[model samples]
Target: MIQLVVSIILYFVIFFGIAFILNMLLRRTWLMAFLYPFVVLIIVDNMSTMEYLKAPGSAFSEAFSRLMQITPVDIAILVAGFAGTIVSGIIIKLLRKSGYQMF
Candidate 1:
């Protein structure tokens, strides 16, 4: 239980920090949120970029198989990370709306 909580917080902070910086630099509120799934795919899949390029079908199939095997706790952690990205986007949007210079 402790490990699960730690994992959730760790993932959330990591994603939030990355997304926050990306939002500040890119000046797009939801860019990181929109790209979070692909980031998760890269993290979860074992295939290299070259492998994915060379054998797209097999790579995607393997990735999907691995995705299917993730436990509920892992899914929760991933969801937390996604939520962090969304929250970062919302914060950035709010900051810009309130006349703060984000860029």
Candidate 2:
């Protein structure tokens, strides 16, 4: 489980690292706080769309036929991604409120 923990930490580090850089680069813009979530959703949508498109015609056409087969995994990923974003947002908000002022 140590490996899992390490990877999770790394994920947050990378995401927050990007946020840190973006906050610095886009300081005082109408972008940083508000645009981030929508940006993430759009990115995720594009990626999933690309994955679907890359599958074979017959396979991709029936991809959702097995939707319930991996419901747990899908739910876990959705929860993790949703929770991660909220947690990260809170982390950034708290850090900024603590006078760090990321944006």
Candidate 3:
């Protein structure tokens, strides 16, 4: 239980920090949120980018199977990471609204 909580918080903080920096540097509030799924895909799927391109059908099938096999705790961690990205976007938007320059 402790480990799960730590994992969730760790993923949230890691994703939040990364997304916050990305939002500032790119000056796009939701860029990280939009790209989070691809980030998750890279984390979840074992296939390399080249493998995905070379054998898209097989790679996608394998990825789907892997995704289906993920545990509930893993899903929760991923959701936390996704929430971090979204919260980062909202924070950036709010900061900009308050006249703070993100870039």
Cα lDDT of model 1 by residue, 44-82, tens digit: 897787888999999989988988888899899999999
Question: What TM-score does prediction 2 earn?
Answer: 0.40
Candidate 2, residue 74: CA error in Å? 1.0
Candidate 1 yields a Cα-based lDDT of 0.91
CA shift at 89, candidate 3, in angstroms? 0.6
- 97: Cα error in model 2, Å: 1.1
Which regions of candidate 2 are displaced past 4 Å?
Answer: 1-70
- The root-mean-square deviation over C-alpha atoms between each candidate and the true structure, in angstroms, is 0.9, 6.4, 1.0
The lDDT of each candidate is 0.91, 0.51, 0.90
Query: Which residue pairs of candidate 3 clash?
Result: none
lDDT string for model 2 (45-69, tens) is 4345565557756444454444434
With a 3 Å backbone cut-off (N, CA, C), the pairs that clash in candidate 2 are: none
The TM-score of predicted model 1 comes to 0.95
